[model samples]
Target: MHDAPLLPVSRRQMLATSGAGFGMLGLASVLDQNSVHAAAPVAPAVSVATANPLAAKAPHHTPKAKRVIFLFMNGGPSHVDTFDPKPELAKQAGKKGPGGKWMPTPFKFANQGQSGI
Candidate 1:
């Protein structure tokens, strides 16, 4: 009975669940592709008033943000040590590290001229 329980709940369960998930996902993808092929081709647009689902529209209200600056680091930055200041960031302060784990910066910060394009 001991070996029976162990065998029944062993690697086979994990493999079966994962295999079934992938199989269902594949089947769904095939069905979606088939349905797309079965769908009728949309008629060519005739007028500017012809509504396009993806067309841009005027906002209901004034936009809060006009410009956005996205500074994407090659790797993730330490939130606490960089922008987000925390009271308990002493452990993460001044520790130089790499990868996705917790890390700290080793560079000096100083005020410079206005930032622009």
Candidate 2:
């Protein structure tokens, strides 16, 4: 027979009741240690907005342009149409590629600008 006395509450209930006390006990020990170490004077609080580099600031000079045009082409232009114009692919248009049959762009890529880039 078990010699231990049975409580009115279940094991789960006992644990739930004592859990907060155990947490507070641990917190008290931490606070006591912090109090001893934190004898040094605290620094003055600085404005976070002013300190932040990304914070918006007034322009140094008066702006000439009132409106801004932002062309956000998600994929921009295709690599085949812009930079890499594969002449061999044009010759073998209906040939098999690495991933199934190669589909070439119908439009002709011209040398653009002085740099031609």
Candidate 3:
């Protein structure tokens, strides 16, 4: 018996079919039970010391600051005083800046607290 000749496949049709076929093949290999790249079995540590798995661990390193004060001061005293203190801008008071004239901060910038950070 003579073997049947293959049909002429267009580049567009071949690419479309082959892309799907390759994707399916890759998915099948990944989903296979006896795959070489299978995930390792996740076994929990069954130790007496680590009985409570949900327990919090000790700090890796002692923090420099004891208390953290997160002040979200938008166009407030903290923003003007602590963070962005424009001394030059203060000197050039009423002078023409980017948008308008440079207005100096009312509150003076000084080291208040013990550790003035």
Top of the candidates by lDDT: 2
Q: What are the TM-scores, per candidate, against the unseen true structure?
A: 0.27, 0.34, 0.28
Clashes of each: 0, 0, 0
| Model number with the top TM-score | 2
What residue runs in model 2 are displaced by over 4 Å at the alpha carbon? 1-45, 56-83
Could you give the C-alpha RMSD of every candidate to the true structure, in order shown? 11.5, 16.9, 16.6
lDDT of each: 0.64, 0.79, 0.78
Misplaced by over 4 Å in model 3 are 1-82, 114-117
Model 3 lDDT on a 0 to 1 scale: 0.78
**Local accuracy of candidate 2 as per-residue lDDT tens digits, 30-67:** 89768966666567487546688687877899999989
RMSD of 3: 16.6
- Model 2 weakest lDDT span, ten residues long: 41-50
Which tens-of-lDDT digit does each residue in 14-117 have in candidate 1? 89879989999999988986795666657766743566756787889999998999987777766544654343444766555474344444444454556320
lDDT of 3 by residue, 1-117 (tens): 999999999999999989999999988987884676777767767753388767777779987898899987666555436565677877899989899998887977777688553
The Cα RMSD in angstroms, rounded to one decimal, for candidate 1 relative to the true structure is 11.5
Task: Give the CA lDDT, 0 to 100, for residue 64 in model 1.
Answer: 98
Error of 2 at 91 (Å): 1.7
Using alpha carbons, what is the TM-score of model 3? 0.28
Better of 1 and 2 by TM-score: 2
TM-score winner, 2 or 3:
2
